[model samples]
Target: MDAVSEIPDYVKRISFIDSNYNWDNERYGDKLQKWLEASSDNRLFVACYDDANALLDGKPFVSKTGGTWHRTYLMQRYLKKKMKRLSWNKTENDSIIYFTADNRRIQFYSRKNPEQKIYHTILVERNGYIQSVFSGTKYEGMGYQFMGRKVYDMYRQNSGSW
Candidate 1:
């Protein structure tokens, strides 16, 4: 449903007076700088628990937040682990998670589950605020499987790595 709409009047009416923009503008630089400053040992996590939490963190069904703006335990863990690939000492050549400027989306590919074809991604709005995240399926209640196994499987990630 997120993509099936027509642009109103051929131009989308988007408002920028939002807290997500302000929150990102204030912290993105500092967090990015901190990530860049981390040593080879890489102690500080760029998208740390407290850091990656968006302004719409606890909110659901946010318009710009990748559909239902849902958050699952499995999705959160995968996102965190995949985000670590953004740290220094990591080479893009070996990257499974890639950032594309085309539409400002961070595409997460499950290398091992290339056949799963879940189509997961995080959208970084032009404002540089990471707001939306589509974790493969629309809703966990829809029986979305990671690697043919249920998300309830605590070790489902072992079935596929994003």
Candidate 2:
């Protein structure tokens, strides 16, 4: 187990997803760092695409949005470039897919309408964290809970561009 200070403060029992699918260098770096800190990545279990070189080759991302295809062009391109970072594998099983990481096995999923979407959405997450994408100025996120205290997105968030 990591020391409390070493771990990023994740939203317990809840997760948020920002549907924007944004990509900015600083934001990307920040998000990546946070993810590495919170995720189950050690030396052996292996994270899919943390390495920049691997990303250039393009890993496994959703070629198809199993539910709602509401992604912007920028989002699509970003996914193509950094899709592997989002998922551990390309194999599609069901809505909730599990992958083993550093310390434990984690699952990745999204809040999409099965009636509308294809099935799988994006990838990557923690037990108590908010999974958001940068939207240039701010993070556009969606909130979901799988484990501890409920994550309320509206609390720390405010309206308008900062």
Candidate 3:
């Protein structure tokens, strides 16, 4: 857990598509441009493309609107990259928290002291954000309680962002 904090925050390159057909078919080329331009709140940070190699100097954030197809596209790409990095091991111990964009679920898995492992999943808005100290899976009580409170607390703490 300490390692997670030590790893400096960096901008991430979010792709819009992957070889797998996990996203709905849609070509918003011009519409996408117009939508992004019209909604100032819908802008994505340029630094996001830097990946973990370069730390972002500014705070990170994502803006989303009524574009399911676009989100699905992004998810496919994001998942593909993550999957490659994960080597198809969804249950890998390295991943404690997983934002499964395709399923719209954020899963938190636990690596118990010895050999126990548990997982909990919660739905979240695509571009929504959360700051949390996610409890492990075996402690279902804390996990469930934090599920509701952590998000609210993060929202309250980051009120100015919205």
Per-candidate TM-score against the hidden true structure: 0.22, 0.26, 0.21
Clashing pairs in 1: none
Q: In terms of TM-score, how similar is model 3 to the real structure?
A: 0.21
C-alpha RMSD by candidate, in order:
18.5, 14.1, 17.9
- Over 1-162, each residue of candidate 2 has an lDDT whose tens digit, in order, gives 122433344532212233333334344433433544464331111111111111212442343431123232233334334534544433244433223222222223323333332222222333233332211112323344332244554465566755
Task: Say which candidate scores most in TM-score.
Answer: 2
Better of 1 and 2 by TM-score: 2
Least lDDT summed over 10 consecutive residues: which range in candidate 3?
45-54
Candidate 2 residue spans exceeding 4 A from truth: 1-15, 18-20, 23-27, 34-92, 98-100, 105-107, 111-114, 117-162
Q: What C-alpha lDDT does candidate 3 achieve relative to the native structure?
A: 0.28
Top model by lDDT, which number? 2
Give the poorly placed runs of model 1, Cα more than 4 Å off.
Answer: 1-23, 43-60, 65-97, 100-162
**lDDT (0 to 1) per candidate:** 0.26, 0.31, 0.28
Q: In candidate 3, what are the lDDT values of residues 1-162, reduced to their tens digit? A: 112322222411112211112233244333333333343233221101112111224432222322222344354345445434322224334422233321222222222212121111221221212222221123324333422444253444565767
